[model samples]
Target: MRRQAVSPSCQQLGRPRSGAASRRGVLSSAAAVLLLAAGQRPSFATLIPDAPVVGDCPECIGEVNETLNACPLDAPSCISTLSDDEEHFAAPWQFDGTREEAIEQLISIATGARFDMGLIDSFGGVRQTDAAAYIAKGVLAVVSGGDMPEQPKRQRKSSTEFVPFDGDVTERRTTPGGAEYVRIVLGTGGGGATQASNLSEVIDCEFLFLPDDNIVDVRASSRVQPEGKLGSGGQLALSITEGLVLDKNVAGRQVERLRKALRWDVAPVLTDFNPAFNAEAPVWFERLFDPFNRRNKFQPSGLAYPAEGEGEERPLRLPARE
Candidate 1:
């Protein structure tokens, strides 16, 4: 007698599910098996067109893999190296006043010099303890500056404006030797999205005030940007230090005493070092792909200073210099 072949759905029906559901599941499984046999697979590149593929640059992939294997699991968080745009100044800048008075004096002198140099548009002391509050205030200041109307030709110095002390402005600490240390962080950056001419920059300044020794030590450093050739971090640091020491009129008796006591020239010494030299890619990866992607570059959606006859309102033109 000839025996009838058992269908997959018929076999599954006796094992578990209802006849209709089992038939559907069996059909789906068969379709998947046929697809696999035909060498058809899902393409991730189709789903994410912009995603980088390792196979695209086999050499880079190999190098990356080698680097990963070479990097130790227990490596130091930060590797210390010399800075290229760091300036250090130490002198007998004795202050015959309390710590609070010294801090106030420093702030006043710094703020005045920055304003005179047109480095900052607006600045204030950081009172709130949290990092969030400090960052929020800085962000708000940038937003406000962006909304501000263009100043008169004579009043406006440069196109760029900065808001400083975007992080912890002042921090006080005591050493095991009972010596007091005060770290004053002075960060300055561009006026945000509105200011197209301005580029973001960060200046990390730490001031160590030692009352017993009657000397104040200062270290100012900034990252050297490839695009920012005109603004030297060394020059910026020197400018501020010079203003503090040489501004006899504003600094009053404290600076006067310090100057008189100092036998040698009080100048900041510049040191150059780059810790990220080998850690990062040789060239910025963004710039490599920038030609293919216009979005990588900044495009002003709205103009802070629109051109004359281009908008509904007449643009304010700067008067020609005599």
Candidate 2:
């Protein structure tokens, strides 16, 4: 994370300062002392604390230092290659909080958006996507949690790790550091995917929390091939890797509004290690019809579309990873 000092002027804006600034500052001195006594740190826009781990995560337990140290700086995209299928990529991000916080934030951000209909719209080509809308929505969801009775339920329950969308088989395993990991995979072209289908698309994603490392590993492969064509070599594969800081202190009615838009249920998905999944009917259904759950209008940027006659093109297959 980049480090910079906050200027006194910036900190004092809107609030009365206690130093030798003005009469208001002198009057606020006692209030400042009370705040300090209460253990409240003055807000510093540029200041962020060191990443802290809370629980034992398999991949992070023994490798905290190495993982945090290896996380790449924020960039338009990651330099590390994800696979060898002549198609790979990496996309990393920097955040303001811990790894667990980042994971929750990512879920909130990704699910809050309207599903990208490839060929017409995409979240990538970051050039066209609205970063503020994405980040703001996620922050609101986290801050509001289950407080808004009007908030919509964004997630559905799923007992089986692998749902029919990615594939029927979701796999769980231990990483090198013994961290619990969930993998969702889908493949349809040649000898790659398990479920046999003619569609030439593949999605492989791994979700894990590195509590020890204070990192969330969201790595995946997205590939596409020409339909009904044999080894056309027109496959497009991109690898994505992201590291984010999550802020747990978000609060405000804006978050409640966002929760309604995302359809997120405040109920915990995993209770004491048992997943509620969509096995039982949702506990709260009032938010679905809430007038406040307004959908955002989306306009797709054509960056994801291929040039005319690029190959025997197939419709894009978006991943539905939890």
Candidate 3:
């Protein structure tokens, strides 16, 4: 005789109340699963399209795998061979210009010369400091009378003056490979100027160029003292380390990162080594060079009159103010 088959729920009827509840729970779970299968897809898969794979380029995958297998030991060799070359001061220039052009440009920077603004526009509205240097050199050539002018001097008070201490071409040489390098040290310090002066400024700077390496390094230090009326009466010091080079790809990446962090697309990075300032300028002080309000003043006696004149005009007094 065949025994009648009993439902699982029917078998649980003889168990405790929890057994009946457990049977209902199982039935509820099965129903829920069926409902889920019938409805829309889960949230994770919704955003991603129904592609077979994400970014599934075989070549890229192979490259990633190869890089990973190299481990930390061989990592240094993985970088491109032509990457940035940091060498001693005697290293040859790595730039893409002729030796004569490089020398002219280096000399221009040693003197306080300004370049054409068009050079900045060439690099897509960015601060191409390297290009600016070359352009400045060209301007210096045009303005110069075949020789650099005398270093500037400023009078601190009666019988006292501050002149550039080491205003000379420190290094001018050609490498064994025929590449030219120029370095100029321009600075003023150790002043015996008058102690009664209200304000005095001292500046020391160095400029170096490696044409073959396409690198420029600038090191500068400046100090401004205000004894009275200039401000609350303190010393304002500034130091800068600026190294620039011609680089587009890495510069573009730098610009992109800056754009994201700043939430605005600013100027492109035209030079690799950006200028660095150790301390921010106080808000009260204006920029050292104001392009808009540049003034040129000179004594007219040197322009026209003789070196010596009559007793009344000896001092060469200009017309009285209106």
Candidate 4:
């Protein structure tokens, strides 16, 4: 695991930050799988015309299998982990929700049951929550006070946008295409890294309500190609996001079965001993990370991104609008 970051600066938003999007694995009869952004066993089988991709390897799977076999028995539940990105700090944190409410709220924060959200900080070291928190922490609480698109009429969206959190830096840019473009900051690295950058990079990304599957998948890969030819720069990198979906049915079934056995409100499976909240979900591994497949109605998270290189991330020169 990497060293924990100290007093990292929070990203300014119009969208979420791009940090460590990984997952862990657990062995299964057919294949290994991880939850969240990491993806299903074979999400993207990029052949590169004739070049080899991740699927071209065999030993990788074996190494992953051995790792899952060693997953710790102790794990935390959604409540504790939720405290970070979600914080149901509304006094009575945990809930004894009705079946319908449970399903609705489950859709809101459920991780593994559906291949929609990130891994269980357990799988490998994904730190899936960072992406959501990057936005939730910085935007959700403040968007209402901003001077831009009033939160979309739709409560559930895939991505949205905002101006730089910095006031003086709020000089907006109008796209050549006659559209509006917003600026924001993104976290360089965390889970414990240095502070966030004061100098914001201008990219065309959006704020979104990504499907939990967007962060985790068992039957697919979740990756977005940067809009340019080569890729992002070394100085200030840029990232494209891909998402996943959970078999809501499968997740519900498992929760149902566990509910019957444990007779608990929400299943205890979400609990973890050494609970990790960030990118520690061990995304690389396939099993511990891969979500048990079933089916669910995945909603689009209104996170936004630039339209191709229309507003790709570029290093700010005018001493960030601070």
Residue lDDT tens for model 2, 83-180: 11111222222344665555454443333333222221233333223544556666787798833223322333233432122222244545576554
Off by over 4 Å in 1: 1-92, 107-170, 189-201, 223-228, 231-322
Which 10-residue span in candidate 2 carries the lowest summed lDDT?
Answer: 294-303
Error of 1 at 137 (Å): 55
Query: Model 4 compared with the native: what TM-score?
Result: 0.13
Model 2 off-target regions past 4 Å?
1-87, 93-169, 173-180, 186-199, 207-322
lDDT of 2: 0.32
In model 4, the worst 10-residue window by lDDT is 68-77
Highest TM-score scorer = 1
Rate residue 9 of model 2 by lDDT: 83
lDDT of 4 by residue, 1-322 (tens): 2233344355532345344321211233224334333553333222111111222121111111111011111211111111111111001112353433433333322221322221232224324454445456557557667533232221221223211111111112333433222211122221222333311111111111112211110110101112222212111221111123221122112233222322233323331111232122222222234544111111111212222244442221221111
What C-alpha lDDT do the candidate models reach, one value each?
0.31, 0.32, 0.29, 0.23
**Candidate 1 local lDDT, 115-164, one digit each (tens):** 33232223322223433455666677688874433322223235354322
Task: After the best TM-score superposition of candidate 3, give how far the Cα of residue 130 lies from its true spot, in angstroms.
Answer: 31
Per model, state how many residue pairs clash: 5, 23, 8, 97
| Model 1's TM-score against the true structure | 0.26
lDDT of 2 at 269: 23
Candidate ranking (lDDT, best to worst) = 2, 1, 3, 4
Q: Estimate each model's TM-score.
A: 0.26, 0.24, 0.21, 0.13
Q: RMSD in angstroms, all models?
A: 25.9, 26.2, 31.9, 27.9
